[model samples]
Target: MVRIAHIADTHLGFRQYNLDEREHDLYNIIDEIAEKILEERVDIVIHSGDLFDSPRPPAQAYYAFKRFLAKISGRVKFFSVLGDHDTPKRRGMPPQKLFDDEIRVLGLTGGDHQVLRLNGRDVLVAGVSHFSRRYREILVEELKKLDVIAASHQVSVIALHQAVDRFFPFEEVFELRLDDLPRNFKYYAMGHLHARTRASFGKGELAYSGSTEIMRSDEISDWEKHGKGFYVVDLSGDKLDVREVNLEGVRPQLEVRIKYDAFDLELKKLVEFLKTYSGRKSPIAHIIVEGKEVDRQRVQQSLNKALLGKVLYFRSRIIEEPEKEFIELKPGDINISALLKEYLRDEKVAEFGYELFKVLKEGDVEEAKKIADEYFRRMMKIDSEKGVS
Candidate 1:
């Protein structure tokens, strides 16, 4: 049987939250992926796209990828397509080209196909790199051409980095539709989205191996559900067999939502979760705190004191519920003093505002000045008591 390891979206060099550990986490995943692919005894490894996180990757990222290539160079053949991130914004060749001839990246800009003899059976791999939404028409034309070419091959496979409307996360924006794809390939290899998916397409299975590491916070759900890894596609059998291989080396990441009311309880749970992974790997925690009124400064202080050294890093997204400004403006319900008191907890300021409003409306400037002086005096006294200037 012809074995093909379908992987994509390695995203090397991505230092999430600007943490050095995050950058290495991606590199570590590459190492683990290499080991897994070799263990599976695959004949070919096809990275659908995004071999590197950037078109011009960091020096360390290049070295990490080189180490992976060293492991699988002679043992297995490697092929890939360019993801949007791996393509340059201006004029420049991708960083993977540095390993020229070692890695086969297909279709830099257009459709390209190659045939390989595996187990005495001809396996055809053809695809185009990621195309922006603007060049989608050209992308369609290229796929049609590749489809015509696939008609001539016995066991044909098409790899694409574009997101199809069928499986794309967004309902409105899409690069290619399912119908836009050619109807003849034996398997459809897709990339870009970091989610594991499989469907019956064309004459065979359509699948996405998903990203090797957790690239974004939103990907946590899929990463947890499917686990991070690649797919092993066996092509020699009558019915195509696609098996998922999850890696054990992926760094753990957590998304915790701490409500204001349950701050202590949730923080305790989060601390315990981190403790479980002690000496194993520090997990990345993305905390979201929600409440109507919260002291952001105090929240940070409490977290710092409780979760110190417990996690690799903790990023909190504080969302404050907006307070009601006015009571939908009514004629007799205009009690400005009550509204001020509700928001301005300082009773002195609220009283001063009420008195000043009455004096100013009556053109009593001296009385308004007197109320302001008294308000400032009270504020100074309170600030002094709190040890503030």
Candidate 2:
């Protein structure tokens, strides 16, 4: 009865909200997982991908992972693959090879297929790293080869860091379809998606271990609903028995959306929510206000006063509604460009607002700032010519 712990998307070194404590939380959670592994005496640990948040992790992150491996050395074997974040920008360079000889890293620079003879049983593991659209063809070719190798083994598991069809709601970054997967694999251990999920794939099962920490605000609701954890797969029998082992020390996150008119009421409610929070540690709060022309300063001050120390971090996003007065414009009565120019004049950036707007629309904020600087310089020149302060 081989017991394997499946964890993924650790994303160590991710400093969410630029908070160093958040990075520390990641390291602590990994230690907690290691402790659990020791308690269970698991046969192996399988990390799907994203061990680090970036290709070049900070020194602290590297040390944290090194310490984790050291804690579990000689007790359990670790098998891992590289996710998009772990892959180096330089071509043909493998990041996993930097690890100590005690660990085995795969799916980069070949060696994607491993056969472990444990307790007189052959456990086959096939891995594939993250691949972009430009390398989709290469990924397909590798999967075809892996399919042949998996077919020859009795117990085969496929590990990949790519989006599976229908598994995630949005597929804008999807790399492969469900049908692209090879058949007859006993289990499919997946990564890349932060939400925990499980689904049947022909005769086998597919599961995502989910990210260990809350990386984004959008993931807060799902994490609150499903909780965050890893999976323990009991592969002693013909059928896989997967059990979820919830982790402690996960930072709590909350999102409160309210209309502009109800800002005060919602603020009070948020205060009450914080007061009733049962988490051992402070949570992260995101307050989103929607309505016309909110007093951003006043609202932010109130939130801060009410939520001070109740959360590890507090941020507010105010979405101003489009002016109702401008919604009734008649077709062809007013030129769009002319109106924009007038608006820019009112905003006091008329000189370069048009250029800035064009660049901003393309999501180049830095270029937009450069245009604004040039406009400022031109204004300074005009002011000097007129001898004005």
Candidate 3:
């Protein structure tokens, strides 16, 4: 049996507020991941990408990484590719070669491929990193020249850090398709998408390990909870099995939509649902109340007080019902906030810049940097705060 661990998007050193505390928590998560691998006794570990939240990780981040790598030395083989966030935007940024041989980093150059031998079977891994804004072929053409099928009789897996498919809005940013892959690999382990999923395309299995941590309120809201972790893959000869090892407990997620007339009754129902499900094993909770008649602040206050700190986030929207059908190109056709979102979605550059502007306008320099990072993240399609294709 060839046991392998697949993890992605660790996003170490992701400090939003309370730098010391957040940084500590971030490293703790990394420790948790490494611990899982050591306990399982996996033969090799593959980190799809996004090891660091920032391209130029803080000294603390590097120190933590080095320490963790030292702990796992000689016990398990580890491999990582450059994620969009891990690679600095400026040209001539240093490569992972600067790190000691104990840490093996792959895909620093535009086109790079790696092959590992596990129990005498060759596991071929190929990848492409975000070098710029323009979306180009994911180097599948170059990968085919390697002839993966002939290299191994035990089993073979391809590691890539690109979007799942082309239907996503940011597909134009990192466009990749299932058909573009080499036909003979047994599994295509992918990253850059923060959802746990498996798809059978061509002749292999395509899988995303998802983000190991929740980076945004939108992600928590969309996924509806927080129990982030990695995928453990077990390979026996030519067969493969995979499972998710969740570090955090399961948190309940609730979304309620009520009409203006039914506010009183629905509000009670929503609260009842929140209270009943909020007592789960998970430490985090997310509740979203959206409708035409929602009282955003009041709902937030009620929910916040009721759940206290257990509620990771609460979002409520107020939208008035339309009296008649909306006329095209007419005023008051769409809700104010809805209209703003629609307008912002079209202009990519301005939309990103404004996200940065929002933090600056609020006079939070550190926060402004975080949001600015997100802007570049959005443009790169690396942030799945929106959704997967």
Best by lDDT: 1
Off by over 4 Å in 1: 169-172, 322-389
lDDT tens digits, residue span 306-336, model 2: 8888888988988778754555544346543
Alpha-carbon RMSD to native, per candidate: 16.9, 9.7, 9.0
TM-score of 1: 0.81
Backbone collision count in every prediction? 0, 0, 1
Clashing pairs in 2: none
- The best-first sequence of candidates by lDDT reads 1, 2, 3
Candidate 1 lDDT by residue in tens digits, 1-389: 88889999998988787789889988888899899989999998889888887777899999999999999989898888898778765568888788887988889879998999888899998989998776999999999999999998868888888888877645323589889999888888888878999999888888988998887787899988889999999888767999999988788888988888888888888787788898878788888887878889988998888878888788887877563353244443556768788889978678777667755753546557766887788888999999997
Over 240-330, each residue of candidate 3 has an lDDT whose tens digit, in order, gives 6777788653233344566656656776675566565544532343343435555667766765666565444455555545522332333
Per-model TM-score on C-alpha atoms:
0.81, 0.80, 0.70
The collision pairs in model 3 are: 292-319
lDDT of each: 0.84, 0.80, 0.62
| Pick by lDDT: 1 or 3, better one | 1
